[model samples]
Target: MDIWKLGAIIWLFKSHVEGRAGIGKFLTSFVDNERKPTTVVFHGICWNNSVKLHVMKELSKAGIRSSQSMSKRTSLIDHTVLLLADLNCTGTDELIINASCIAQATQRELHRLPYRWLVLSDAPRSGRSSLWDPFLVDSELVLATVDGAGYTMTEVYKPSPTSPAILTPRGTFQHVLTDTRPHRELFRRRRDLMGVPLTITNTIQESNSSIYHLLQEDSLELEHDLISKNSYTLAKVAFLTLNATPVATFTNSFGYLQNGQWTGVIKELLEYNADIGTNVGMSQSRLKQVMFLDPLDNGRARFIFRQPALSVTANIFSLPFSPDVWIATGLSSFVAGVAYYLSTRLIKTRAEKGTVRDAYLLTMSALSQQGCEVQPRHVSARIVLWVVFTSMMALYAAYGANIVVLLQAPSTSVNSLATLAKSKLALGAADVNYNHFLFRASSDPVRNDIAKRVNSDKGPKAFYGLTEGVEKIRKGLFAFHSVVEPVYRQIDRTFQEKEKCDLMELDYIGYAAFHVPGSKKSPYLELLRVTFKRLREVGIKSAVNFRFEARRPSCKESIAMFSSVGITEMRPVLIFMAYGVALSVAVTAAELLVFHANRYRLRQRRVAVQLGRI
Candidate 1:
């Protein structure tokens, strides 16, 4: 009878060992097949070595790597960690104490929370225990615990950024000792918040320079800048798709990193005070602090200015006709000049005594439509003169017509960043938060030089107010670095239709658009991504973008609207006139010198002759 009892006890112990092993097997399968983590970290007290070792051994068997160190901090955003805790290690009846110990051990190492958790204990699952209270609000986690002969799992997630972690049962893994079926549905679709409340923050300074302002609940808009407006609207659409309530908060700035810390919207996200950030421009530095979703605006920040005058861009005298046409004109003039010279020599007329130089001068006078004292009376010479006159008259008429058109046409030379940097146009940027920072931070040589020029000219006040910048752009020769939509709106209101015809832009900040940002390892990130993708796929996003951002206003007025020519437009002509005057002065000086020399020589000759006669 004693042998029979001993055998029954051994059988019971074997069943318990198999049950524990089966739990380890299931966890190994989940980690290896489902999560497929590159590196898995294990955190457990010394007393929980058996449970951790069993799982680690199984993971190793499945060709997975595991780490035992818990002191080093790792980004939970990219890496997955599995934590196991023995709830009975402390000999405490209270579950909160055990949970607190687990939270404290990991809270320092993991800035956020672990990817998965397993709690082992002989105690029954209780309703009064606050096991998940120590973690950050809405941690979006999956945890499992021993439930009788089987195991039960629950997920902790937030419906919104401000909401507390909601614990929901994810069903149980029964028949652990014999079950071979894979259940991939446990963690899938867990991101669907099922109508939770989230908080989204934006930079809505109370000052007049704010990117956006509150018009109503969940309604934000910008008067001049539409980038923030469009993003805000898209974020709202995402929240609706998730059936989550969005709470809006406003701050003074988008956020700036100062003294190794962040300020404004970025600070709120880092501290987990907000779920998502609106109108956040993506940058390498910002990416380290938070995760950004799909780009809301792909529009680049650029230097917008009027196209410069053609004369300012190129020599107006040479631009009216092509090189070939100019060559033909020169050849024709030479032939006419030479013919007139030969005609005078072959058929000498009493009225016309044309030397080589005189014939060339006469040809130029005909081209210029000027009168000459000498006339060739011979019929052949006269016929040659008429042909030259008629051809030059037609060429001069075409040249004049082209010059008039070119005077009004815009210059296309300053269309790219390299050209813009080399151009004489004065550079400035809108006084928004990111311009100065991005400009100075750029590594490109051209951008660096542009930033330097702006700072050298304007110093600390290098940036201009939107209206002030737009006003300078309208005044001409000023390239204001700003997003297009806001500048377009300002241009639409103040600039004339004729002025719009010359409006041009050069790419400065090359971002496709500003993106909506969320906290690092945000649970709503995927939902935000899918929501945006859906909006784009269905063309809703395009509609919202079109409504807020303004395109370049069309040129309604005739481009030939007459205005008095400024020095900038007539620069080539002025330069030509200055050269002509300088040459004329030089020739007059040479002639005077020659006249003085001739007078001196003649006087000496006269003196010699008088002396000889005496």
Candidate 2:
């Protein structure tokens, strides 16, 4: 039978326990015909909270009740002895049965609630056994008090070959936090301990900003002031020891039923190989895997493309309207010319024989936005001409104003996703981006077309890296799809203001993030939940991001060094200028042809008159 077990014994004293100490130790015994003691102080710590509940159940069945000390003043006076393990112990308790012992917490202060104590037959040194830390008296001290008075220590445990050694439950025992400084307790459980070492994974080592590099310092050292780098970095701080591996990837479909099987970090967690999953995108499908805690960050996948540079020496007047509008105006001028010939040729009009040619020139001049040279003498022709001239005057004035505006402000390269998709430029996306999958699966025809374009042979070749994609975009006639943060960082580090000014990014895809545990049964998952919540309340997480951010791109005008009146910005104006010049040349050619024909007719009439007289 266990030495600490109750045995058939009796307590002679039924009197009240009234003394100087109120709760002292040694020779306090109450026994039955069992193997264990009638009074026992069950050991406890934060990590052992769940196990402690079970021990309480076992104690109750043994016909004994244990003492509980929640706060510092929770009345250990109810029992005869307390297993007081003090974090700041400088006290002593002697084992009267055999040896005198010095407790690590000999000198008690205001209270001994936080202090953890151990009593033994004798103090054991460090090397002989991994179980015992020998600064305290490791005695199997049991107690039974009378009334609200001093209690007695019922049993003492001494180590020997014949006697079984009393053991502290390692699995249930929580670690005593060395730092007693108070905090918001948002990320920490009310009573929980670092029960065991855990395995965790992170992104592969390619950059310093990756989760792997951020958590390196914490993984190497155990006791230091916690400095968080990111959400996952802060999560790592909760564990005193972690076996971190490089396997965390941006997985959105980890636990989802994929082709009748499951994959990703969630699988490793389920199998108990990894304790926590980092930087996993949150989704309803993934929630079925383990569990998702707080988000690491929020971000979007969008298009980043080169912006067209500003133009110079533009035919600013013509830019107010489109090419189609200009074409319609020219066709209207031809119709007006035909109308004048019909309205005047049969009416015996007051105009001269060259009136047909003059009318055509006048119509052309009106459409070109110039003053007409011919004046009409007939009322019907005059009305048609004046109406055309008035409309032309309003158009001319508007074009002049718009030209001034164009000269002051430049145009953009691509204004929207629709423009980018319709453009002949090569489009690409980083092979690792999960949004590509979402885009390809889009129901919208425009988005579907864009996805097909990117995956096509004329688009970006498959599996190109972000750096390569960025290089292609910088060369112009190219666009890339990626998350904003990483691409923003690269541009911040690489591009000048002039180069980055025209670059435009469009937001199209956003995803929710989550941190997952190895299994639903993981005890530490609760600690993670609490810690994650605390981190947010403390303002460690902001709307933009959780950590370091890059400066946005900016620039002054005339930074391109050399540019021109680019066709992209001055298309309408240039087309109008060309149309006006062509019309003027044609009008001049018509006048010369008419003048020569009129001279030939007069010469022929004179020769006929001379022949008749002979």
Task: Supply every candidate's count of residue pairs whose N, Cα or C atoms clash at under 3 angstroms.
Answer: 5, 39
The TM-score, computed over Cα atoms with residue i paired to residue i, of candidate 2 is 0.49
Cα lDDT of model 2 overall?
0.49
What TM-score, over all chains together, does every model reach?
0.78, 0.49
Task: At residue 484, give the lDDT of candidate 2.
Answer: 57
Please report the candidate that would top lDDT against the real structure. 1
RMSD of each: 5.2, 15.7
